[model samples]
Target: MLYYFSLCNILLLYLILISLTFLMLGFYFIMNGIIYFIEYELFMLNGSQVIMTLLFDWMSLIFMGFVLFISSLIIYYSSEYMSGDKYLDRFIILVLMFIFSMMFMIISPNLISILLGWDGLGLVSYCLVIYYQNIKSFNAGMITALSNRVGDSMLLMSIAWMFSYGSWNYFMYIDFFSFNFDVKIIGLLIVISAMTKSAQIPFSPWLPAAMAAPTPVSSLVHSSTLVTAGVYLLIRFNPLYLDSSLSLFMLFISLITMFMSGFCANYEFDLKKIIALSTLSQLGLMMSILSFGYIYLAYFHLLTHALFKALLFMCSGVVIHSFKDCQDIRYLGNLYIQMPLTCICFTISSLCLCGMPFLSGFYSKDLILELYSSCYINMFSYFLYYFSTGLSVSYSIRLIYYLIISDFSFYCYHSIYDEGWIMLKGMFIMVIVSIFGGSMLMWLLFPTPYLVIIPFYLKLMVLLICLFGGWLGYMINKFNLYDIMINLNYNNLCSYFGFMWFMPYITVKISYIYLLMGLKLNKSGDYGWFEMLGGQGLFYMLNDFSLKNQNIQNNIFNLFYIFISFWFILLFLM
Candidate 1:
């Protein structure tokens, strides 16, 4: 019945949405499918409306194009990749579910509807992650699924609070301010969920865990797909951020996530894990810029990052597929000779990622830095811009150096078999864009495309700063000179928060001494405090009550639970 209700709701949502769209959605999907076949780009700035009380904006449509583009690629790419796997039907079903959920998320008519799609994305992705359902992979997938559930819970509660406060006024973007509850409280909840989704700093472990999935799956998640959904959510809630005045808080968190993950990625051995961590860092950089209210720059970087990151992941997948499932970069070497096209594609993407001058990374990254520099009118904001700019360069350069120049000493040092033309063609197109699209974008942003533009040269100068910063990062990794490699002691993190990680050991040791003393005294029980007063006593009383009347116990239990929950909610609000 619940499934049927959800299905009816989803169908009802589509009916309302389809009625609003000028072009037929079915026809549009078919046309996108065909255009996907042609290897041609479409310049479409589409329309949207407030249907079913949800404000569907132009930005939502733009992001939807990205969602469809990547989902189509995943379907296109995985149809071949997962062809011989035994769970082929299951894979296709999960893919369809994922694609459907992504569409719902993009065009969701309400906060609740968007959240439903978010949960669906998490569910289907977890299934696809362990599609083979192997024990180790299943464990990883389950952990990530659990994390998503926690994030979902926070998001659901936040949306409920927002709606309850805003009531009917919650129908559109302008209605957020109509709510009576603390905007700061509401904003924190939204940002918390966003951080977990985007894999920011402390919550960053999930993406690496998600690498338990197939390479194609990882590619989609990294490149403007599900992992990005969180940042996109934050972007969507720009009104909330502006209301809460929490942009500085957001920028700080993003900057920390950016550099820290980058440093960590340097030490990782798994091919997918490295890319996944790099994606986290790069997305963090974009989110940090996004917090500055430069939405266009953030969106542009997202588009640029989508291209090179997906291309890199696809290329990496080919490499891993060849190694008979060995994913350690340490076990991969000198494949430029054997898989020339894949190597070229990977190199181009790596350079693009590094923000090398004249590359796609250069344009997107340079614009963000330009935006950052403009924020230097204020000293605090200037310091933030300075730190984040340095972090971006560090992480970007680290990824390139590890993939291209590091001495990983691959044990399986064999030539790669030539992949099919489908893979090669995708790589070919992506590399061209990675190299030259930066120049085109620079032209779009500046007058005379640089002929009448000294301001543009200043942009070039900022571009030089990024390149030099990346070069410094290359030297840092190339020298092997950091204690960052040996810093994985999680016990240290626990201790840094001033909790002794050895508390359990110390407690057990002291307990043993107490046990020896108690044995000497012939005392049997370790129970005390609440246990001595009403613990077993209360249980026995409950058991006696149950023996007297089971119905009475059930009613009492439900009554107190409801009363306490009501009081707690009141207290929390206060």
Candidate 2:
């Protein structure tokens, strides 16, 4: 036990040291406007070089810093969370592998290298998701793996397409060949790949389903690493596709994803799933902003969201741990009475999610909304964006009410307490960053402030929507038997909204069809058709033929014996 504890501390220290180093380097690079690229040529084929490249831009370095920092804190928290688990060491190794995979993905400019990291993330995430070894975890892991495989396939196709360009280092030719047909195809493929990784629109269900993983993995994966890989990829490829029609398509898809996820989060009851849905909504916001060609703003929000979201998950983990693994929010009430520190951190993170004034989310979310308003988008998109923002606040307020404001809903006899010091230590660090990480990142990422010249009504719209949304959330929790009956009348509608508009069902059905096909193929190819036509069928045919020949020989022997007996009788009579 002590060895495991020491192992966690050592890992935590190393990750933190590396994170600080990366962060300092990132700051220096940003300050000096320096971009360094290091390349190692592995070999050449047909004059097309295959080189492993690492990019040391402010973006990659800072993102890496954030990833490692969050990873370190999560690891420390997990030391306490998974203290009793027998496979704690295995868990730690998997997490370290995940961190390394993320680092590789963050720094690599080569498509081939990116795929290696990308595939590693998908594979490791699958392993982590099924860590609990239950049916649900297994299902969740399968869904996570298969869904990500789509993105992997897309990325592989993009790599194959890029082979025509003589080098897979996309950074070298993306801008130069921005208007080329092959480049456009590669861009489209990359967009699809990013969509799958980021869980956009049709691909959104996996994010919430991935909640089957442990809370610490949840904090790390959902916050800054796995899900954000798609947005990061798009940000890297922003120069190539920002001017194309793909950006417009991405805009619509991202807004709908934002609206859908925010709406679903309100209807969700599971604590982790709610947080996961919120992550989905935030990812949509990032993708939407990226689609609008504001790359830095998207990146800024990504960093800030990572801080608060991780804190949110950490606090939820504490609550769930104290509740003896009860994740249904209805059973969790008055947590503030038992876990005051955790409740405080949870409330702060929830408010940050709501874009409350001066919070981390406010800086980035406000800027994104303001910049979105300033854009020349359609009114439909405008409505979706603001409405989605309101829904975010709605769900957040609803969660806070269920967890902290309401009376205790658990059993009469319960022993819920905030006892994990190491977990609290981790949450404490995140809380500080969740409060101030936004403004700090904002100033550093964008040295020049963006100018927005929107009307007063437009600016005031956000405040009004937030207030209205909060009121709606409070009302939602105040439902009586009458409201329940009224909702029952709209059961299908409620289920549709609650189930992420049946996106999971769609994914399941698609997978089910493939599984069914595979079953049929296995039966026909291996058992039915092949069995009849191959060795088994030949053996049966040969056995029957030999049996017939033996029967014929037996009949011939019987006839000869009859003749010999008849001849012997005749000879004796003579």
Candidate 3:
């Protein structure tokens, strides 16, 4: 047993080393301006070929490197976090499978191979999400799996749709199919598929619900791997969306998702759920940026967000574990005094998330803001972007107040430990990256920086929003204004925000209501009408005839004589 546990750690360490080597190699290639693309046939079907293809430009390499790095850290951290569990080996295996699936998707340019990786991710994530074997975990896993299956089915449809072109490798014909109507159909399907995977708007509940998984899984899958797969797909399929109506549609949906999740996060009480909501919000930001044809900027933000968000989750895991699995922020307070290192990491991550200057998020977020300011967006888009920005700060401040500044509100007596060195060490790696990754990536990824001019007020827009949100969050959380508002005939409004702007209600109406109606129809029509008119009805009528003919069969000899007389009479009449 001990050997198995040690083996898990060893495997993670080996993967980390390999990933670091590849990361450095990728950087070398980038610095020297190299691109590697390869393809080979795996099989032949009806004179067509099934091929394995790889495309490694700066994008895939950097993205692959980041995915591997984060997965390794998560696996390393899980070693200690999951030490006493009976199924530790199983957990490690799942994590490794999830990582492999992500790597496969990253390297593949063939739509077939991408679907292979895509389905693999969805299946493995469901397993990981349901690892706890509780009702909540089971339901969450079902929701997560079913939600992603929507994307999987859409991807399959795209592959079949592409059959008309006689090839499943989208990269080969990306330029040729730019303005084709079929290409638009495929692009629309891809956009919806991405929406499902990224948990945009109507598909968003599964993301937060998936926090029922273990915290390590949350840190890994929710923060880095599963959620980002959609954005990565869009990065690969960027050509399909240029000047397309679907891009504008996606932009609006992404904006709504961004604002909705940010608003939901402020009302969220569960620590892991809050982090999950933040992930959803960041995904929205990525998708929104992608819709604008700034795929590189979106990718840049995706990478940086993965760094700090994973660290943030790891910090949340430490706090939850330390508090004996209590994740309610209302019960969590004075963590800065109790768990100093974890607190420090969490604070830094929160600051980065809020786009504080010079952090990893600062660089990417600053670029996004600059680009938004420079774009020819209408007033609605402008409001949504800046409003979402303020909401991000609002939630960050609200969380900090509840988790760090408030008095410790729990009744249980306990000693807070700065142990869990393994977890903290994993977090430290990301912390260093989160502190400087933005500046480094900005320098590396952008050869020529974007030039955008803005007025003084526009330049300080994010700052002003943050200030306003911080003040509002402080007043609501710290000074009891939320309590006063809740008591004074605003409970219904509070519930709406608390329930994520009625998204859950809307989802139930659309999803569950339809599901129930289908079941009812099946019961009444297929089972009721069809059963009566088809199988059971036929069986009952045949059985009644058989019973009526029982005497005739028993008197076969007499019936034979009667048949002879009838035949004689017929012959005479003829």
lDDT of each: 0.66, 0.91, 0.86
Q: Arrange candidates, best lDDT first.
A: 2, 3, 1
Which rank order by TM-score, best down to worst? Answer: 3, 2, 1
- True-structure lDDT of candidate 2: 0.91
Error of 1 at 471 (Å): 3.2
Q: Identify the leading candidate in terms of TM-score.
A: 3
**Candidate 2 lowest-lDDT run of ten:** 478-487
- Which ten contiguous residues of candidate 1 have the minimum total lDDT? 33-42
- Model 1 residue 369 lDDT score: 67
Which candidate number maximizes lDDT?
2
Q: What clash count goes with each model? A: 0, 0, 0
Q: For residues 1-574, could you state the per-residue lDDT of candidate 2 as single tens digits?
A: 8888899899899999999999999999999999999988889999977677999999999999999999999999999999989989999999999999999999999898999999999999999999999999999999999999999999999988876787777778766774778777888999999999999988888899899999999999989899999999999989767888999989889999999999988888899999999999999899999988999889888899999999999999999898889999989888887889999999999999999999999999888888888998888989999999999998998999998888789999989888999999999999998998888887887888888899999898878888888888888886632248456797777789889999999999999999999999999999998888998999999999999999988799788999999999999999
Candidate 2, 134: how far from true, in Å? 0.9
Q: Give model 1's TM-score versus the native structure.
A: 0.70
* Candidate 3 steric clashes: 0
Error of 3 at 207 (Å): 1.1
TM-score of every candidate relative to the true structure: 0.70, 0.92, 0.93
Off by over 4 Å in 2: 43-50, 480-488, 530-574
Better of 1 and 2 by lDDT: 2
Query: Which portions of model 1 miss their true places by more than 4 Å?
Result: 1-56, 165-180, 243-245, 376-408, 411-415, 433-461, 476-574
